[model samples]
Target: MMRVKNFAHSTFATTNHQTMADAQALLQKADKKAASGGGGGFSRFFGGGTTNYEDAAELYIQAANAFKLQRMSKEAGQSFEKAAAMQLKTDEKDDAPNTLVEAYKVYRKTDPEDAARVMESAIQMYTAKGNFRRAATNKSDLAGLYELELSDIPKALEAYDVAGEWFSGDQAEALANKAWLKVGELAALQEDYARAIARFEDVARSSVSNNLTRYSVKEYFFKAGLCHIASGDLVATKRAFDTYLNLDPGFMSTREFELLQDIVTAIESADQELFTEKVFGYDQLSKLDKWKTTLLLKIKNGIEDEPDLT
Candidate 1:
């Protein structure tokens, strides 16, 4: 950014139109390289990759700025569009759904309705590529973008359901967490708790996932416990809460600790709730186990951040 500012200052100070134009050209080249998945990374230590949209976006964005600097709005529009297309590639879907989100960033002048068309194009591209995971995820994302910015909830749900179909294994956990956490507040929203619980249980039960306290696992246990409690299935509730405690025991403040005791006192009746709920406990109903990673087989993927768009 400092370099950019310095270059701008130098370019604008020059009386020679030709020199100014040349400077602009260099900037354009850099942008083009960035859009083309070239140039240096965004953050050198954790920089650009072909799989990331930033690399592709930087290129086309540079091209757009070049056109804009030259007072070529039409040409700039074209570059922005090109950037959008490049960003929407199936492999780069993780970065953000280019068809909608990326396009909005680059082509802010475009109508929201038009953006919907672009999103549709992205969905089609995903589907055509035969990457069901991306297709479903992007479709759901587009639906969300549409609903939020365009007041189109029905369309949004449709997109979410489309994504739901592909939400199996890792995909399933991802989608269910999204459904549970983000849309959980929506009264009209309906989550297939049975299916989602199964997916969460898959993660909870799997030996593959390690001791990480990720939101995914947390949501899984939390939602399972909530579902059991809602159904009055004390045993299932206890089990779910037990799993929760197993995952995160440190949340037991003194008051919460006593609550666990009260719930445990009724463990017998609670066990009976198992007949109704197929789960255990009246609480997420026990003291947390304080880092069950101690006993579990932990695989270290070493991924720290939850990722922005994922």
Candidate 2:
């Protein structure tokens, strides 16, 4: 029995563990009936034209909880398994068991190999119900996990490709999510920023009046500018910064923004000697590369987005 945990003062939160225990007990009882030799597992538990879906699902929910707590992953997976079966019989399609996700989460944590085996089961459940898209989606997430957590980049790329086929172009939020994740991942890995900048730029362009337009173009310009700086295109970098500051004249923390404004002033004035000290040589930017690149990117993201205090 789980002590009731406070949920925002509503105070009626039972742990998932309790649910799992009840479910396990139900499965055991059903198993016993099947073992008596008269009925096969499927018919005795889910068949016989005797539909008590409400009871079956309730049992499953409890089992899910128990499996989660006791870490009986296989049992928990089966619990959601049983619940999904019950739902189908009752035509309670809306009651599609969420147990698959629950089971997958647990199974992945301890036994990843088993988790892959279980994900197939989840796909089976969704496919049986004629939900092809959901099956595909779950499969994609599963593959992504393998790629990211398991370090299977090729497999991960495959998953991402399949997910792309899920018509994400029509779904702004989902597309944005994938794009954001890719860009951030590449940046952290320091993989070529050119591709990342392109991804971010796509997001910025698409956001113009729909999903992305919420943030100003100044942000996009800043991002693109940093990419230019990284690729050693000083000329383009200045152009990006120029656009960024022009969009928000009083933008940035006073000192940094002023520094940038000074750079612009110097560059425009054609002060070769003064600007030489501020900028870097591509060949010369070795050990301290990331910091210099980061400083440039930060200058763009912050200055353009921040309001002018000066």
Which one is best on TM-score? Answer: 2
lDDT of each: 0.49, 0.55
lDDT of 2 at 87: 58
Q: What value of lDDT does candidate 1 attain over all alpha carbons?
A: 0.49
TM-score of 2: 0.50
The lowest-lDDT stretch of 10 consecutive residues in candidate 1 is 294-303
Highest-scoring model, lDDT: 2
Question: Residue-wise lDDT of candidate 2 within 1-310, one digit each (tens)?
Answer: 2334445334323545455556658777544433332333586475533344545665666656666666677777667766665655565655553555666776676666666666777677776876656766776777667765676655554555455444254353554446354543344245456655665555555555553453444445444544654455567666756655555453453333344445455444545444444544422543325544564554444335534444
Q: Which portions of model 2 miss their true places by more than 4 Å?
A: 1-24, 32-61, 71-74, 82-97, 112-170, 174-184, 187-195, 210-216, 224-310
Cα lDDT tens digits, model 1, 197-259, are 554455444422544434345444544444343344467667766665665564333334333
User: What TM-score does model 1 achieve against the real structure?
Assistant: 0.39
lDDT of 1 at 204: 48
